[model samples]
Target: MVDRLEQSKALASDVRLTILTWLKTPALHFPHQVTGDPAEIGVCVTLLADTLRISQPTVSRHLEVLRRAGFLRVRRIGRWSFFARDEITLSDYAEWLRDTL
Candidate 1:
């Protein structure tokens, strides 16, 4: 089983939570990419960094935390990595939370 403490730690950060919320409606919050499909491949790291008004490395670090927690999914297409919410994982976490609490 996944560690509850780890999950809580991942969600505890405001930046991470914001990333999750922005990912929910990527089309609305993020701009269109020149190459990839936002709806399909997910939002690009550069776009996310720009939208968040933070450095690319900083955004990447936050994304990594979410990814590790199973809250986000990553797709490596060519040079850039795209991020999207893992619906199944989120659902399972929600169910786990309900039972645990």
Candidate 2:
């Protein structure tokens, strides 16, 4: 779909890919992560901010863009909203990108 291409374009940046990579290895990139269960519980924006050395608001903005473009998903637990890559959508998108391009 055209929308998928647009979303792919949005994610073409290396920073976005780095973000995904960090999410894939939360414990390595981010300290204070529990010994187990970052993937299930998702990641906090503050941890992302500290790890990536980016401003909190800037990280939030990138996350918002990723969410809007369908590469990321959010889960709200009580007051905090955690984030993770949307593997289903991302997998399909990868296949689509390969097929299309």
Candidate 3:
């Protein structure tokens, strides 16, 4: 289970929110990847960095937070990392919001 406080903190930033929003519909937000499917395998870290106009390390930091919060899942292919949203967790969080708020 995800820590509610951590999940809330993960959603606190505008940049993080944008990242989640883009990831929610990667095909619409990101370019066609060469290796894996965006929806299935996830978006590449390099692609996310380029799209966000941020350093890879910076993007990694944000991704780490979301990962810890259980909002994202990562897949390693060679030396590259791909990220996708945890839809079940997202739905749970939404339901949590509806119940709690």
Which numbered prediction scores highest in lDDT against the true structure? 3
For candidate 3, lDDT tens digit of each residue in 52-74?
Answer: 99999999999999999999999
Worst 10 residues of 1 by lDDT: 30-39
- lDDT scores for all predictions? 0.88, 0.78, 0.92
Number of backbone clashes in candidate 1: 0
CA lDDT, candidate 2, residue 66: 86
TM agreement with the true structure for every prediction? 0.92, 0.84, 0.95
**Model 1, span 1-101: residue lDDT tens:** 88777878999989999999888888777757765667777899999899889999999999999999999999998998999999898889989899988
TM-score attained by model 1: 0.92
RMSD of 3: 1.0
Which 10-residue span in candidate 3 carries the lowest summed lDDT? 28-37
Superposed model 1: Cα runs more than 4 Å off: none
Could you arrange the candidates by lDDT from highest to lowest? 3, 1, 2
